[model samples]
Target: MRPDSAVSVPDMPAIDLQDVSKTYGSVVALDQVSLRVEAGEWLAVMGPSGSGKTTLVNLAGCLDTPSSGSVWVDGVDVSSFSRRELARFRAEKIGFIFQQFHLVPYLTALENILLAQYFHSLADAAEAMAALERVGMAHRARHLPGQLSGGEQQRVSIARALINDPAIILADEPTGNLDERNEEAVMELLRAAHQAGKTLVMVTHDPTIARYADRRIQLHHGRITDISIFSEDDEREFDQILSKLWTLRENHEPLHDDSLRIAGPLSVGRAIAAMTARGWLCRENGRITLLPPGEKRASDLIRRHRLTELLFSHTFELRNEAELEDQAFKFEHSLSPEATARICAFLGHPRACPHGSPIPQGDCCPAAS
Candidate 1:
């Protein structure tokens, strides 16, 4: 479907924002912004306080409407949804996670997750148990939120978000309440969920945590400042290309101009031309196919892209999706292959770009090592 037509219908963007704006009297919480997040994408929203990160998420999750512009979840525009429509939309399409666990004080982990299902139907204990199991928290399912550690409570919260099989999960600092170790643990769970094809968008101040996203978006003073899928550096050029390819594998869409920023101006035509000149590309069914060195080269590029995205997302505390991608693109092509590989190892072989694409495999990925 055309991008424009999809805006009004029940579309499937884990989250979609189109020239969306929100204002409170004289204060603008969000300026005009347009973004689209596909299914299974994990997008991190970053910014300093009052940058409109929360406002954007609220708009996407149906908690708030844009003062002007449009908000769509899974293709359905909810800008003017009625109270019942809003409630139903939230119940069927969105799952929310906050810094605070928000578990009912009197409820066990199992009960907490089950309570979420009650909105749609009667609470189902068995379903709740399965949800807990998915988060690796089944053993603690009977434990009350207060009895669990911050990380554990967060896990229960995540399970609750999943109880209804939501199309998108909106996480606002899911790791904020935990220490370093617990934060890592919670991030691991989130990573697993992303790998399993859940669409996730998170708002976070912690750059390190944000690196776990498929894409990082930075918001500045109520406007999108930048977006990134990788980091910058000479050695990372190939990795950026590979990363883009992995992300676009299923769609075959041409890389966007913004994406080109990651690895310099080397266009797909240029990359293919260069590779073909070197006997690395073979045409197959009007599409380019990699052979031998082609795959290796692609893998190297992906490694660099992933590493760059990781580093910049951490360094700048970027949450705005566009800014993060721009930063990664600027420096990703300069990293040495060895350095890029090391960074990838440090980051635990991320499977997709911040926008949720599989990371191409070659000498730079974990298995390659």
Candidate 2:
């Protein structure tokens, strides 16, 4: 589409890439890849070091053009645009969050937000203040980037991103520089942004961060390896509870009043309340026991986890259980019944994980005994 005539379709995807590749010298940053992000969707990109997560984000944000493919943002082919056009398009359509605060050192938090609007057209003090207020940073609007804490600066960055009302937001390791408390606070704002109809693409090394997104994709050696779509809140919640139960069993531990610590960032009291309401857990003699249904659900989780550990070991030859642990957790949470069964058959239903943990026998596996 011509640059002037290009217009976004509310129902169509906000970002789309076809056969995209990015290379630098002899190193390939991203391989042939096609991806689409639906409007209003939150997508998380995850990978280890040098895995091309940032390369993908830079392409999506129009900071760099693909070496051998096409990229469309909001229905326009960005690579076709001139430098001026690309700058204008980004000003109008994209918002960015970075690991560093990247705020002007001398600018007040409120002025920093207005800076983004100034680039796009004209600054509105009312809108700038409102953006900061939305992120709970209004109280510190006059603080300089140097004067604000890391978390506070990040909040200002978020406000700046939203100030322009961009259709798409790309955040790279946004919380990597923050403490745990600040990480949660910033993530809550990102979630709020997603809920407000912005297409969000975030790249991070942390799985906990990925859960906030509606879907997550894993990149490895410049290629997409795994994608998990969390379409239902109930399903993710159930998976979380079941995974926690298996963890307690594996460690031969009993539940405590603070059992939610095992679930990571979840409220122990709230989880217990929900579990009680859902009949997933029952208290007996001060011990939490999974009901029969809960036990059955947790068994599947256990099986998937063991199988995933084996798969990673075989494919990557990980040196130890710790090395395979995160990959196993991600796979276990994302794998479907059908995919789990296929792995069960492919590994000939291994009787044990590398760590000597018994692999539960599923329908596709031979007898455990």
Candidate 3:
């Protein structure tokens, strides 16, 4: 069947995994998983580490076979195909964007775009040019990947992914390495691609990033914990809980049943129940503590909030204390990790927030000089 044949009457899922499971020896990567992605839709996969997000993507992309059960793509059982046939499916029907920006250092931007075509069909320079033009990178077609900045290289990678005009795009943390502006640049391209009818599957840890998709699924220990089509109200509630947890962390206080209830509708009990279920909180002795994953999430939120304060105070020349606080609240949610890192790097990794609390060191911070 043609790749585009995935178009259905809104009832048939584009990709389906029925009772699928994958194991690496004793490690269960995906446990009897089943999922569906509709044609021309965008789906976001989210989970904490070791939650089987990557395994699902690999199986769907035909990069790895499930240990048991079955894998289907575009309504075809992919596990039935031989190795060569699977490779052909990937070449003809899938495009990929990786967080690592996997580009050939020796190839020019134009050459990289043409590389995808060489595998699936003849390499056409005009076709490659059009791909680059779509990504606003036509002028730098002759430049090698190494010659470009992080964002520029990522843009070129986006061009390469589009060269095939694939029906599906699989992106694993596509904005992972990009710093602020570049992350947005790449996401814009992805957003455009989804709008143009490709089925998109992306894995990201950020709720903000996941919000860009039409639906999101959360996984844990190889099981789907929650699947949400997402309403702003739900995201707002989650963000509220995250912020409240950060405040408790800052105070060095163990959260109790009394501590939650940051925003609308979610009661303190419901919040703790939800957070505990997600492995974000542990309740013992009537107090709650954040796990490693929770700490990381809370830390990132704190960084964004404070970094926004820094930007408004200095970059935007805002001086009113109250006004800056309001601005920071508005700016915090949309800031990506890359953007936060850039701000931290640019600010020389300041040790304190505007409130005099110490800022946590992010990966982008230069080693102490």
Q: Model 3 reaches what TM-score against the true structure?
A: 0.74
Ranking by lDDT: 3, 2, 1
**Deviating ranges (above 4 Å) for candidate 2:** 1-8, 231-369
Which scores greater on TM-score, model 2 or model 3?
3
Arrange candidates by TM-score, descending. 3, 2, 1
Task: Write down the lDDT that model 1 would get.
Answer: 0.74
**Residue range 137-205, candidate 1, lDDT tens digits:** 999988887889888888888888877877678999898889766787788778877886778999997
Candidate with better lDDT, 1 vs 3:
3
* Error of model 1, residue 21, in angstroms: 1.0
Q: Quote the RMSD, in angstroms, for model 2.
A: 17.3
Q: Which ten residues in a row have the lowest lDDT in candidate 2?
A: 1-10
Q: How well is each residue in 239-333 modelled by candidate 3, as lDDT tens digits?
A: 67777777876898767766774656666666566656555668898877777766877778777788778877878878888999988898877
lDDT of 2 by residue, 163-268 (tens): 7778899999999999867998999899888987789999987655776888888888999987766445545665676667677777888855555454434456
Task: Quickly count the clashes in candidate 1.
Answer: 58
Compared with the true structure, the alpha-carbon lDDT of candidate 3 equals: 0.82
Q: Residue 67 CA error for candidate 3 (Å)?
A: 3.9
